[model samples]
Structure formats: structure tokens, C-alpha cells
Target: MTTKTSDSPLPWPPAAEQLPPHLRLMGIAAAKWVVQPVYVLAKLGAADHLAEEELSTAALADRLKVRCDPLRRCLRAAASVGIFRETEQDHWALTDTADHLRTDAQMSLRDFTVLLGEAPMWAPFGHIMDVMRQDTPAFDAVHGQPMYAHLAEDDELARTYHGAWSSLTEGVMRALTTAYDFSRFATIADLGGGDGTALRILLATHPQLRGILMDLSHSGEIHQGADRAFEERLRTVSGRLPDDVPPGADAYFLKNTLHCLSPDLVLQTLRRIRSEMTRPEQRLLIVEGVVQQGNGFDWSKLMDIEVMVNNGGREHSLEEWRTLLSQSGFRLTSAREVLHPQWLLEAEAA
Candidate 1:
């Protein structure tokens, strides 16, 4: 996550680089079709089976429990987009992007891709028009239950859901820890921190920092090894947000939690946290994809639509975040874009 930033100047898009409106429109429509093969490859563990070597389609098919003909087609489709490389006529190997799809690979997106490909998750997008009309979550309309509730009832589904989220937390934490200093605080509380991945990273990085991981419950859901490693300092507390949070922590970390709530709920949650603060020095650090305002396309814009459709959540702009914090009796003191599409919004008692 400690990537280099370009200081050299670069020219803007030249006139020759611009495409015709029709071709651009076609490219946009084709994106949906392109993601299918990538998702299929990740779900089937095809990249993992490749073993970092160019394997014939038949061999890969045997490993994946699929027919050779269709399996070859799938690998070829992914190769076309540079996910995998076709070394020979029927032999394929993982590319740099496809390498990350391997099950055991570091920073793997395989689980996240599988979760996204699940029927319940993507089916809601089909009724996107209706979701926009109703102004309610499409997932709830399609499944007759909220997303988290549906996951909780099924153990396997819940693991997959949490795994997908944890996979993302690793990268985000790396970037954040590098960009900001958490050593100033002796105790840090992670509200709704799924699996305690972020807190584990923080505690490991800052040895002096004691931690608290609070969520709906601390059943078999959290990583036991992480707890045992820092058992003396890291406490797993079960509680709901807004209505409850551990008081007296020097700082409260709410990474990717606020964007899951509506405006009113967010305000209520922040106000509740504000009441818990015993000192003006206590901080609230919210890490999320703060929507950037512009006419051009960006990832947060797309994420905003997805969050709205799936969870009735909206990714807020910086101004909106400031307003929300102000309304909750906290002042937005600092805003830093530690990573692209993700910003660290810091607030203190107003």
C-alpha cells in the first residue's frame, strides 16, 4: 500500500486519444459482460489451480470439475482482458491481475469476487430502476430481509460475507496506518470492526496501543488467534453502535461503518458517540470512500450507487461529511486522502 506518487508532469488526453461517442457507449455497455468471466474464474479457483504455470485447458478443466471445451472458453475470455495469459494454443497461466485471484495469494480478491457473483447480491441490480423509484434498498425488496440479517441466518453465507469484507480491510489498513499516526493514543476502539482485521493491524503496528473490538456479538465470528495474541490488551466487546460504545478511549475508529447508514441514522449515531466523549480531546476518525464531486467518472460515484441500492446508504461528499459532523456536535478538523477513493475524516468535540 506504500506506493510511489508521480511528481513528474504529464500531458492531458490528446485529441487523438478521444473516442467517438458511439464507441465509448459500446465500451460502457461491454463492461458488464467483461466482469462475468473474471468472476467465474475467481469463483472456480481456476487461477489457483494454474499453479503459476501454463497448463493446458483440459488439465485445468479436470482440476476445476468442468468440461474442457467450456473451461477453455472461460480462460480464453479472461485472458483477452489480461487477467490470464494464453501462453500457447490451449495453455493458460495467471497474469499479474489473475495472480491475486489465487486462493492463497496475498491480498487476494477471490473471496470478494465470489461474494459479488452470488445471485442474491447481483440480482438486486436487475431492479435498479425500481430501487431508484422506491428510494429503498433493492436487496431488501428482492430478498425480503436486510442484507446483514440474511447473512446471519446462514453460517456459510455469513462467513463469505465477512471474509469479503475482511479481505478489503487488510489493504485499507495498510494504507491508513502508513498515512496516519495512531501511536498518540494508548487505547483505540474499532466500532463494528468485522473480524478485527484492522484492529489487529493497529495493535501489531503500535505495540503500546491497547484495543477494543466491538460489534453485534463476539461469538465464533472474530478471529480467535488475533484475540489470543493480544488477549491482555485487546478486548472483544459485544455491543451495538450509536446506542452503545466503550467510553474513555482516546480515539474511536469507524472505518467503512458510517456509509452503511442513512443521513438521519448517521447523525444519531455520531451524536450518541459525542455524548460518550468525556473530553474534547477524544477523536472520531471515519475512513470511507468520500465521494468526490466532478463531472468525470470515479469509483466512488459507482460505489455510491451500489451502496444505495444494496444498503440504502450513500457515500457522502466532503461537504456532506462536514455537515453531518457539525450537526452531531463534532467539528470536522481534518480531511486527508490517504488513498485514492478513500479519505480519512477526523473530527473532535464541537
Candidate 2:
């Protein structure tokens, strides 16, 4: 089946190849400190305050209850990166980029920013050397627990972590709904669908289709809104992957879930889904980024590093995808780019 192609614009911070060799390397080195200011701004909720009106640094600092001088410096650093703008002496306003940092923004990045800057997520990067030399994830080394397990113990952190994923998934779901045809499947199960974001988009897009959203027990509260909205057509199940797959759906989907798992786990998860397929016609759709084959810059390569550090998971190339699916008793039928770096791979029981 044919799907629409992406017209999305290229991401900012221009590609490394666009710059002179020396400057490119220098920019890469300087990038380490760039997120710090933005993180501080997000943590302070500066963008929310700025949304009402431009304010002097002193007033903004007072509202946020932080030291005026350091807050101003942080604002200046963020302004330098186009996140905010200094309108006049000591007065700052939100730039278009910074507006997305507001909590009420339709596409908010505030939680995602805070998540990346938080100690549990950021401190692990320092142990990347350990991840490389010893095979232990930097996150495990730093926190002595897996990322999800740590989140389980901290309710506030869990909210931020899941909220950040929900924010990130919203746009991806929009892209996916338009890029692939789901009308063919009368029912679809979103395995490990966090917060039911994808199912919300899919069911909204194709009115004829019903959906099952299966995630961990902790996601029950998160699914309440979706449950209320589409009460009749939607089913919410508390379950984990590589098992607990409910059967009898026309198709099953795993979006942004496999990459968070180890290879064996991924295989087991796929096999579990395969076992639940009662019909030969039942399909499986995997939505994730495929590592490109080139020396060129690709975002998936960068995400691969994050996955490695955080959970010992990984991004896969097309070859790797084929092998995994084959081992799990499915045949890859089509793989198309729905968004830059993200692909929609359709497979059927083999």
C-alpha cells in the first residue's frame, strides 16, 4: 500500500559538513555546555513566564526565586542559541524555538529538556568510558539500577520520564498516521505502547479500526484519558513485553519500544507477538530508526549511543532488522521512511 512522503523541514543546528573542518570540530567540543543553559531555563519555567510578556531579567529571576545575576547569565546563554532573545538591556523574550518550552504549548519540549538535564540521565554520560571499556551501561554504573527500575522507585521522576516520551511520541504518531495505511486492519494492538499516544492517533485517524494499548501496570493512570475518550473502541491492558501479548488482533504494532530492549529481549518480544498471531494474514509493524550505511551524519547513530549508555539497547540497520524478524518467524515485506530517520517496517508471519 502507498503512503504519503514527508515534507517536514530539516532539523536545525546545521549539519557538521556545512561548516569548515576546524570550526566543525570546535563546535562539537563547545556543544557539551550548550544544553546546560537551556536545561536551567526549562527547570526554572522561564518560558512559561515569558509567554505572557517580556520581562526584565531581575523580574524574571524574582518570579522564579533564583539569584538574579546567574539567571540573567543563563538567559543570555540560551538567547545566544536562539532559544530566547534579549529585546533590550536586561529584558528577555521567548523566541519561536523557546515557545515550545512552555508547559501548555501544543508541542512542549520542557519535560524532555528537564529529563535530559536531570542527574539520573545526565550523570551517566560521564561513565561512557566505562560503557565502552567494560560493557556495562553508563546508567547502570552510575545509578546501580536500570533506568526503568529507578523510575519505578521515584514517582516524580517517573512522571517526567513518561511525560517526556509522550511529548516526543505525539509528533511521531502524527507522522506515522499519515505515512502508513491502517484502514486495512480492523483491529490493532499497540504492544508496549507508552501512555497510549500512538493508539490515540491511529484510532483517531481510522475510525473503522479498534485498538488495544498494552503497557506496564504503571501506565494505567496514564491511559485513563484515552480510555475515557474512546471508551468503546479502545482496550487498555496492563502488561509487559516478550510476554503478555493478547491475541486475536488483525495487526500488532511496536513503536519505539524494541530499541529500548536488548537483542534477545527484542527477539523474544517479536516471537511472543508471532505466537499470538492466529492467522497467516496478521501483520506486524515496527516503527523505529534504521541506521544508514554511510560516513554521513545520521541522527540514529547518535541515538544508538544514548541507547547504549542508558540501557544497553541499540538502533538497528535494515540488515539487522531483517535478521531479527527472520529469527522471530516473520518476513519483512516493506520498509519505508515515514519520517527522517524513522521507518515503518511491515512484516507478516512467515
Candidate 3:
């Protein structure tokens, strides 16, 4: 929900107090471009196609089956944000932002773009009103099913939706890998770990350690692993939590997944993990973006709204996470805010 600023005033629109007739009368129309152009280019696979070669507006429009004029404007807007580059004579190429969308790029976010634009993803916005009116999750109104069920039922959505986390969590994964030593934990369960992206990183570090990716059984091999030994230590398990924690798993990892639920629900998730702790030394490490206090962030605030509409959820303050874990009978063993700013909290069975 933390949106990229594209000439749009993010903190919110200015007060309509006073304005010259031309500008004031138009009033806050700038915010609309941020919403429209992003979806347009995202759907076009603009970056994916451009990865091979720069394309002129006419060619890009032809590839996407659209008219040239509006497409040119969309491309220009994205270029202003440095997502795409206007090379010369209207041709466009990829920048770091566009690099994320390529099919074979070291870092690809095609899935993220696809998920963000899909109806299951966008439909929640339509019911934001209902969420405000009834103080509940808007997903049911949007999909006629629980969010989890909807994700499970629609494979395309489930894959793309889950991959958005892959794109977003890559930063946190680096923070975690850099901040902690994984060699200590003999066995780990990456709870709700979609494609085992985190496990891939941890296994490579620990060498002797083994990991269980407990979520979608079909989270296809994340491309060809660069490290074969690490790939061997990692195993995929299709199932829910508690049951999914493989035998002898002394370590549990639940990232980004925790803050999406209410405190009571978090308690249940913790209790389930606690039930699987075979030894007193077993621990649960959760990585999530904590809702920081004091300074306000557009990401946290807008994500707060996103969670509310999608799951009746919100990111937690560190204290809120601690309380949630404590209520579920876990003791906070250590807490670290990774240098990247996304906080990682580790807890142990009390």
C-alpha cells in the first residue's frame, strides 16, 4: 500500500482553501494519475517485454494492443519515476525499477505487478466502504469467499498473490540473512513460506541445516537453485501450520504472515507453533514490517487500510506483537530491527 510517488502528493491532498480559478477549480485531480497509469503499464508487461530491447511508443502499443497516445503518456509517467527509461526518439528501456519485471532478471516482480492489478487484489478496494461501514474485512464482498479460500481456489491468483510477498520480502530476507546466523538451528520450518524463498537463503548459510517450506505444495522450484547442496537441504511440504512443521524442527520461521491478522488470531498461530516445539530450546522467529510509532509512514498507514479491507488486519507495533506472542504463552527471547527497517522478532516457548 505504500505507493510510489509519481508527481502525486502522497500525504494526502492539499486543503482546498484558496486557489487561482484555473488550478483551484480543478481540485486534487493529480491523485488520479497515480492510480490509473500504474495499472496500465503493469498490465502491459512493459518492463518484461522491454527487457529484451527498447520499444518505441507505437511498437509498445502494438505489442500491448492499445492506442499510442495514452500509452506514450503512461510510459512517460513511469519513466519519470525511473521505472522505465525513455531512451531516444520515444524508445523506452528498463531501469532498476523496470529490472524487477523481467522474466529472467536476477530480480523479477512480474508476479507482484500481476497480483497488484488483478481483480481479487483490486476488488477489496470496492468494499473499502463496506469495511468502513461495518468494521470488517471486505474480501467477502469482493470474492464471495474468505480471502484464504479465494487464494486457495484461484491458482493463478494464489501464485501471483503469494509472489508479491516474494518481491516485497526479498529486502527483509536480506536483512534477516545478514543480521542473524542460521547455523544454530538444526532444523527449521518456514511456516506459511510460499515458495521457500527464505529457506533457500537460510539453507545456503547453514549448510548442515534442513528446512521445511510449509505452505502451497505446488510452490514450484524457485527457478534453478544456484546452490545444489542448499537445494538438497530444503524440502517442500503442502499443508497448514502445526501439522506442517516437520519432525525435529527446532526452529520456526513465520515472516510477513503474522501481522496480517488480529491479535487473537496471532495467538492461535503461535499456539500451533508452540505445540510443535519438541525441545525447550525450540524457537519461533517472525519477520514483519512493524508499525513504527512517532514518525508516520505512508506505507504503514495505507497498508493498515489494505489489511483492514482485505482481512480485518493491520501491522503491529513492537509492543503489540510482544503482547500477542505473550498472550499465546511465548516469551520474547530476542528482538532485532534489521538495518533495512523491517523488524524481525524472535520468540521462544515459555
Q: Rate the local accuracy (lDDT) of all candidates.
A: 0.80, 0.84, 0.72
Q: Candidate 2's residue-wise lDDT over 1-350, tens digit each? A: 11112222322343556777777677666775678888989988999998888889989989999999999888877776677878657788877788889998888999989998998899999888887788777888898888877887888888888778787788888988877888788999998887788888888889899989898878766656554558688888888888799889999998888998889999999999989886987999998999999898898999999899998899999999999999999999999998777899999999
What ordering of candidates by lDDT runs from best to worst?
2, 1, 3
Q: Model 1: runs farther than 4 Å from truth? A: 1-19, 218-220
After TM-score superposition, what is the CA distance of residue 143 in candidate 3 from its true location, in Å? 0.7
How much lDDT does candidate 1 score? 0.80
Question: Which residues of candidate 2, in runs, are more than 4 Å off?
Answer: 1-23, 226-229
Q: For residues 1-350, write the lDDT of model 3, one tens digit per residue.
A: 11222332322233345455556445456654554575678767777677677778999899989999999898877666556778669887776666777655565677776676677778788767787678568887767877877887888788777677776676677767878877788888888887777887677666778888877555645535456676677777677643445566878888877656766677787887777775887888988767767765546556777777887778887788888888888988888788444677888888
Q: TM-scores across all candidates?
A: 0.91, 0.91, 0.82
For lDDT, candidate 1 versus 3, the one ahead is: 1
